[model samples]
Target: MDLERLYREDHTFFKVIVGDFNAKIGPRRTAEERHFGTHGVEWNEQGERLSKFIMTTHTIHGNSQFQKPSHLRWTWESPGGQFHLPDRRRCCSEVLHGIGPSSPPR
Candidate 1:
């Protein structure tokens, strides 16, 4: 399956995902409680898909709910003038427990 190729069971237990996710964590963590919170723009389809991806793979979205300034969270400005956080760093087990609902290391 396409998803199978996204992860590997080779000797590594930790993974750092970085790329153009083209998704937003959004401002509603109700359905995606652990991986998101109330911040950023409104949630969209990609965010919903990403929520499932993270949950299914035991991964945590880099947009932890620890509370940081909005400016630091965005990486680019949309042509429509919306700040877009199109990239993120997702992590999996062996190191997930130590994250403590905090933003990724600076």
Candidate 2:
């Protein structure tokens, strides 16, 4: 995708990408502490892909950077009211470091 292309072309630019990636990266894993936090849902197939991309591109998962209440974590609720999904945000480490501790907006 465009992100991959951008990363391939240049590795120095400050970048921040936010959107509904439809990928569930879940909570932080053993080796993923640098990229994820402790307040995410379960991981899925797409989550693996996105996680790989984040690692490969040296990007931080913005949504997973802070601790949020379970209620505020998900961006979409199922029509049946039985499920919730997240839309993620990612940014270069440079940008991530500039941000201070805070919670996600309601």
Best by the lDDT measure: 2
lDDT of each: 0.65, 0.77
Over the stretch 31-55, how does candidate 2's per-residue lDDT look in tens digits?
Answer: 7568887777889898898988888
Across residues 28-105, which tens digit of lDDT does each residue of candidate 1 receive?
546646665555565668777877777777776766556687667665657887675544465333544446557577
Model 1 backbone overlap count: 0
Pairs of residues at least 3 apart in sequence or in different chains that clash in candidate 2: none
Q: Where's the lowest-lDDT run of ten residues in candidate 1?
A: 86-95
Which portions of model 2 miss their true places by more than 4 Å?
Answer: 10-12, 77-106
Candidate 1 whole-model C-alpha lDDT, 0 to 1: 0.65
User: Cα deviation of 83 in candidate 1 (Å)?
Assistant: 16
C-alpha positional error of residue 51 in candidate 2 after TM-score superposition, expressed in Å = 0.2
Q: Supply the global lDDT for candidate 2.
A: 0.77
**Model number with the top TM-score:** 2
